[model samples]
Target: MKKIYLSFLLFHYCVLLFAQTPPAQTWYQNSDGINTSVKERWNEDENGFKHGKYIRYDIASNQIKDVYFVKEVGNYSHGKKQGEWIGYTCCNYREESSIISYQGNFLNDKKTGIWKEFIQQDFLHGTNIYQEGTYVNNVREGEWKNTMGVMLGDGTVRTYAEASTRKGFKTIYRNGEAINAYDDKGIDLIENDKQENLNKTIETEFNNCYSIENYKNFRAKYPNSDFDSEATIRINKLESEKQKLILAKSEEDEYLNPLLQKWDSMPDTSKTVTFFKDYYKEFPNGYRKDDVKKRTDIIWNYYDEIKSKYEREGEDIGILNAFFQRYPNITTPSLDEWLESKIEKNASVYKSQIESLISKNTDESLKLALSKLDVINRCNRLLHNSYSLIFSIQHSLLNWKLGNTELALKEINIHKNDIVDFSSGKEKYSSVFKKYYKEYKLGYPNEKEVWKQILLIINQ
Candidate 1:
């Protein structure tokens, strides 16, 4: 029963101590000599720098004030300290005491760099060091630890490893020990082994920023130093690829309008009709689909005019019929496929028939047909599926006129190349195509090939 009562009493006392709020400190006296007092209006001390202590004065209130930091002892004007004033930690209306003994080096009146404090054994209670501080007004204004407390910009008063601030929270620490600190999520900010490495790296980089010269030198010395280097390289590469994509977009916009104009003006010849037919197949998503359809409708209207004029009309007519027979799925074969199938066999016959109707046909009909041919050329370059059989045949025809007879013949035989080599486009077809386009270029190897080769470089 006695033990239980003792435990209960101890718990209550601890709770009271933890909840205790220290009273605010007052400016009671100025050993250095700038006057701030309940007796007088306080003002800025102009001689603060010379005296080494800034403002000083006293509070006469009955309420106990916190500790005051005094520099030197003497009467000072302009609210500054004069000769040798000592610093003390006073509490309970100045009845309690804490003081540092100073000797040796003094720069002006302030302690230069390192000053050691000696305390009575009773004050330390078995420990070598003792420290404490308090708040005044909304600021963390007070005499701190055994050492002069440095007022942190964060509004916290620093006294050795312990700190208290405007927020009214306190932390206590032993001389040579560590603690795991956590945020609201219970995430350990310092001692968690899993994320400690990442945290340290981030902290180092952040601190490096304040030391610009050292940071730059470190980066120059180690180009691929850490994750930061890899991220920098990736961002640079992405920006370069984006620039290339922008240039490709500008090239695509150039031929769109002129091609539409040409399609509006053509005559219904086999080549003109075939051009628009392929144009639609290649560019289903093109802006000119309606224009191609309109031009196609005009051709059937004039179909009868050519039918009656030639003795060899039947031969040309058979070719058109063959196109329908071969591609039953094509509802619209722009050049009457029947006419084109017969063109080579009945070329001389069709020529004579065209001559007979030359005077009767409008010049607009001939001009429009020529324009349609041009539109088809531009569409094939920009939008066609160049790997398809029809595109290969067209490419062959175009290359034949450009005097590249070898490439023209190769294009016509693309199916044979695909059959002989299982790799097709990647191996046989690409080899043939690149020999003409890629090999001739300087300083730019096929990067895909180079990467593949690099992987196999160490193979036995």
Candidate 2:
């Protein structure tokens, strides 16, 4: 309970200290600075350049929160510090107690225009000991009030001794030196000014920018910068990755569009014909979209009508295969499996017929093999049933070797090259190859012979 109460007090104290400074955000690296220990704590723009309000804190101190960096913040443009910046002397800052140290305008790294410097009698006591006049380019000019109490810019008059400031004198200044000494209270503070650092920062500028346009802009602005060569290399890498994503999306659409189209044709589809009509009305010149008219139950019923004619006569695999060749894109897994089964059944019946004619060495068995090969090529080849089609190819070739002159060399010529695509090493291709091999086999093809024939066609 004591630890919890102490933590609540510490949280509120730290919040008051950083109220004018950066809130509870994160810190990043600024490797370009002369001092290695100074860290930049700010957000970056698209090009990895430090943008917006920036604070550079000294991590050299061992303390968890350094007292000097409480409110010393400035604006950063193109990763360079610019505009009005406030600097503080060391230790804790409580608004009622902490005095205003030195506030001024910075042009990159150089101090310019009016500035104020403070001397505190006691640290964090909110007391200003002395003052100086206006400055033009790091030098003092005009009249300066030499009072014991410092009249703060926020209409607060404060001194270590309460009523001792009303009886002070004035001093005149030229260049950076004082012409006349007014009193012995405040010492001359003109030579105590620190050097300000500012210039184009994008010019050790990839932690600099995460976007291509920002890197390009950096290159354009600082064409002769040392990082220009590396920026060009990064741009090329980003572009190459972008093109690879485009090609991958195109391949995905090729497989996906048919599934999407077939799915949309169903009556209970989530986005049906009415959805497309609404979309077409919204985007008249939409990509690859054409005018679609409303249709009734005629489409799916008509497909079923065609399917009926082939399967009615005790499942004619040849005519059923021709139906698939005409409408290859529309079928689902159930329909594809059904057709492959029909082909396997037909092939089994014909295999026995061909074996009976082995002694005869006739053209009749050759013609039967050639006809079955045509049916497999038209139907299963679309889905690339490698084992099924490979069996048909090797069987037709063996029958041709038996001296039956019913030549159809086109089956061997076409599929030999095309079947190699199924060996893509994807699980989908591997599953299809295994499925057909288990279901049907006429002339057995070993792994080596199967791959050899598939590749040999490519070279030819």
Candidate 3:
């Protein structure tokens, strides 16, 4: 199995390596040569002085992306911090981490202007604590505000933020003089020493705060404070993390519930146009897509079958009708109209052949005419269950010509009840009978009297 490795490395190769460092760990030392969470990658002059773009971050594990982010980014002008700097929190806990935390400005290695830290989230779900204030020559000055509350996320810099439960501590400063200090709750901590001795523990494991200045101020105000200070002040935000939860599925449920299983279980013969069309709608991609490519074969396979039948037997209305019923849109020809035209053509062919036979009749000619008439009658009955009176009568005449009186009677018996209603003056076939009778009388001058016997047997 190929393992995905965390990609990050401190490489300098006239180097423009996209995105990340190698999976191997490399420690980043703080200003005091102590391994702090901060790591740095920046351009430096020939004398090893930081210059050009500078970036640093603490690496964390991300399930969605396996890459090292260049977190704290700023510019360095010849070994001196310059321009804007943004710091990000890191190290994979709970398979995720906050993308950004703090952004501030630096001028000649000194923190200046406004600075804000965003994420208060840690290794577990937690609250948000943020700091926004001004720094003059590396000294916290002007109106500095530290808020302990909650906020989601936004872009680069903001003049204000909305937190759900916001409690801000503000101190107004003028010419290096701390004039007033007040929190949102109006807690007068300035000149009020009551909270100085409050819940204080320097034990790093409790993971309380993440501000060095905050803890240092605590230690200064209350020297006897037993509060923790193992840089957990800076690490406390990591306590709140987002854990990726996945519900394990049973093997049977996992395998059988997919659409793929449904498709596999379907019979190949049952894979009709309607079935495959619905399957395409269900699974528009992947294996279904590959199967759709086989659609040409499937569609042509069916059309080819119909074509073969059409070639062998020549236009079976029953087969064409059944085909049109199943697949109406497969062919460009309107099958309904096409079938109607074919039936009319067949009917006309039968009419012409029957009319031509009236001129000269033989046992062989009558036999062939009867065969075609029987097929035409069968097709009409199969399609609409309606009797073609002329075809039926033609069948009887053929049998009468062959001297098969009983079969002639058998042939006319089935249409007996409907024959009168079928051949009534109101029916379309009545005219056909009249036209055929006018010509038919010339061929068999005894056809009228013979038709009388035919009629007698049909009614019987």
Candidate 4:
């Protein structure tokens, strides 16, 4: 019982010792040309190690000028720092306008978990040096983000602002050693500044030209630039525009050549209905469609005059022949048939006139004769065999009169096979002109034999 009582007294004494409050303590010192002060509860463990909250400050200046301020604020465990800690700098002793330098968790006097470190350039701007990842047993592990920034002036003056204009990079750390640092484009952040400068240079060059060759040259110089994709898009657009311009120029040139060479210098008399007909047939959707219409009106007026003259004069062979001569590809069947009957009834008179015209021996005269024969054949709607035979015979006769036997034979041979092919078809007359076949046959009974003899002459 005495031993139990003595144990109880000893236990009460131990409780009193453990429950005593530690006195508040303060200390001041000068270092690095600045005065500093620390205040805390002088609590200590049995081993005489500090415990509980601790605070520190630089008192050299009420405003932060050259000295660090608010150095640390954190708790302690058996003299080792632990739990959340904050280290910041301030311009005032009252902690006004303070810059948080570091803030994060601690364990046994070692930094652990997420921690951020900042650099204060001025009162309002700061740079985040790093935002580190988790710490395992005081060793940095996993990813960390780092950033850097610079102050921007407003041309006339400078002002402190939040350091939001920062470019960031990611670094992988293992045991507090960085394994890799890279940006979003996978370019090494260590070399990012150099690459960024190069990109700016390329952009300046590109903006000056905005051409495909310019972009292509940029790619050639900086093959690994971050703006490669953008450059490619620009090149495609520029090349497409270039091709469109080339095609437009080609179309313009094509339309211009024929206008200058053929249509511009055509004679008034030559510009009959046939001239407009051929023009529309060749250039149906020409760029000068309005001009084509205007020119066509001129030819139509001439055609109206010819038609009126023919109706009033009752088929003067000379005037009828002249109209047909001008437009060989055109046919007026009734007018052509009336002229044909007039020629046959007065063969001597018509032949004399034709011989006089032929005596000139010009290309225009030859073309006119060929044109008249073509109109006659078309008006009569001759069969393919009969039409070819009659046209060839007439063409050959004209060439014979011109003493061009070789050219006449050349023309005959060119149509020889076509004539043979048609004769084998058993239709001696064109189906559309079957009613006129008897008159045609009577005019040329031995046309096939005649064409065959001409072919023999040509082959010889």
Instruction: Please give the RMSD to the true structure for each candidate, in Å.
Output: 25.6, 27.2, 25.2, 21.8
lDDT per residue as tens, model 3, 1-460:
1111211222221024224443232347565667655465666687877788766654544566554545666788988999888765553344333344678889999988888766644444332546677888876677766565212121112122433346476666654455555567665545343243234233432345445556555566556545534444443443332111111223323432564456467654344444455445544543335544565366557666765776586765445544554454443335334555666566766667765664467666767776776666654533332336766667665666666667766766665555223323444333444454455543543556777875565445
* Per-residue lDDT of model 2, residues 144-177, tens digit only: 6554633333334334343244334344566755
Which number leads on lDDT? Answer: 4
By lDDT, the better pick of 1 and 2 is 2
- Could you tell me every candidate's TM-score relative to the true structure? 0.23, 0.26, 0.31, 0.30
Query: RMSD of model 1, in Å?
Result: 25.6
Error of 1 at 177 (Å): 30
Tell me the tens digit of each residue's lDDT in model 4 across 193-311: 44556678877876675678878988888687677788889889888988987776577557655764576686544444344455456556655666767666654565667667766
* Most TM-score-accurate candidate: 3
lDDT, model 4, position 457: 51
Ranking by TM-score: 3, 4, 2, 1
For candidate 2, what is the lDDT? 0.52
Q: What stretches of model 4 exceed 4 Å from their correct place?
A: 1-23, 30-42, 60-69, 92-95, 126-129, 149-164, 190-460
